[model samples]
Target: MGAYISTFPTGFAGLIPTALQKLLPGAQVVQVYDGLVHYRYGGKPGDLGKVFLFHNTFLVLREFQGPASQMDSMVRSAAGIKSLPPSRGSFRVRYSVKNQFVAVPKERTRQLEGKIAALTHAKVDRVSPDTEYWFLQRSEGVGFFCRLLGRRQATERDLHPGELRPELAYLMASLAKLGRDSVVLDPFAGYGAIPKQVLGYFPYAMVLVSDLDRDRAVDLRASLGGKRGVSVAQRDALTLEGIPGATVDAIITDPPWGYYEEIEDIQVFYRGMFASFRRVLKPRGQVVLLSARKREAEAAAQEMGFPLRQRYDTLVNGKKAAVYLLEVGPAL
Candidate 1:
């Protein structure tokens, strides 16, 4: 079986591998290009937002005036191409023709549906019934992949307090691979976007969300009530031991990057955070952090015996963001 993986710009691609590793574990990543990647899985695709939690990787289908080989080659030349495994297979491809100006035109959408029928040698009436045909798009082109399809809810536009953007929520959810029985923690839970996404997947797992801002903490509590097993507290990051020991399983946090120099002393903040993370995390718990200053995070983690597992770059709110995965000392 095949599955599609989508990522945002830069470090977004990094989120995909971590999510894939956690959810699809041993599955091979078979192909990748631009905004889309394919994974080979033996079992049915897991419930991404409900049961088997995994990141939402978009299946973008672009329509180009040029040949498919040209599109493939152009994508191969992009910077993050190295993250994907080499491509070698004859998979079915789908394309549609229409005015490429307006967004997701229904006429074009129908035309694409007809193409899938022709490719599979199925009749036009059977196209709608087919379980295959994954759809994705960008500004310049559209692409279609034939595979099992699942529709995601339209992305929410309203921003919660302190949420930088919707993409950050997506990134956090993708990084944690939040699913059933997965406990998630966000020490710097600004408006609780990270915990919110985690609970979206595993409603049963206890989510611990804390923030320095009391009002934001209150907002998060109101936003997540009765949706998941949630606990919210107003506390500074330096003083987070109020929570019980070894209580959290995974952490997906975007700490203050100090871009505006709001964090007066960056090193001190890192030192305190490292200590706090070590105190609360279980031996096998993983930390996925997004920061602009990679060196600071890397140095602090090293000093505190947290091994840096991997790093990726992605654009967050049009700014370059670095994402890192850290595991407790000397194990992985």
Candidate 2:
């Protein structure tokens, strides 16, 4: 089986391996470069989006030299200038230039595009929503990949600003290991993106979503609720009323990012959230949270006794952020 190349957001490279380990266990995962992973399963892994923000996955036909020799390698690897096909679709060629292929001239880039067109026997349509091909300039060489899945819609969904992205949401859910019959909660379920993605990825898990914004909560409660096993309500994260202590299997939440909620004391806000999560989560249960503000979140987590179990450096809206998985307490 030819390896499939999965691409992710720049800083989210850490999530690729973790998600693949869980979903495609026993499959070989090679981090060929930053933001890229090469893996091959025995059989087709249906719906790769269930794992996380996989920008796209493609079948690698060949790997060879970058820049000066990239075009030659691609042309030859794809069979040295194939004859034109009568009804061939367009191709979106992605040229990834880094250290190896730096200082290239504009003429070289244009030449590479021409080479790609020749290989596909089709036009290089950057605008057309068509078959895609990726070229990465690596230290070893420039790897060429033919797009198999043109569009990976797992992370592309209706979401509000400041709401958690579906890609990140899936990652958070996967970290919790939530599955069939599990009672999972998203305390600050803004616009319900968290629950929506969770349901889409792990349909069997029982999701309890709560949001403070009454209007958004109502809409999400109507739309994001009533899936295979989903419930939604308007509730405050600081006070998870009617929820008993130590009952929740996991709490995966994206708390207010300070800018959207206009929080005066973000530290105090974070501390309250941690305390609430600590109350509802069962012993050894996990709390996965993402925030752009690092210092405040780190301080509050430490003070509230939620030590970090896993951390992924991330980017949100072009700002630095991180995903934290915190353990409840000492394991039984």
For model 1, the local distance difference test gives 0.58
Residues 244-289, candidate 1, lDDT per residue (tens digit)? 7677778788788887648887767887897888777788678888
Q: How many residue-pair clashes does candidate 2 contain?
A: 0
Q: Kindly report which residue stretches of model 1 are placed more than 4 angstroms away from their true locations once superposed.
A: 1-9, 12-30, 37-157, 160-171, 177-182, 330-332
lDDT against true structure, model 2: 0.71
TM-score per model over all chains: 0.59, 0.78
Error of 2 at 48 (Å): 6.7
lDDT of 2 by residue, 231-264 (tens): 7888888989878898888888888879766899
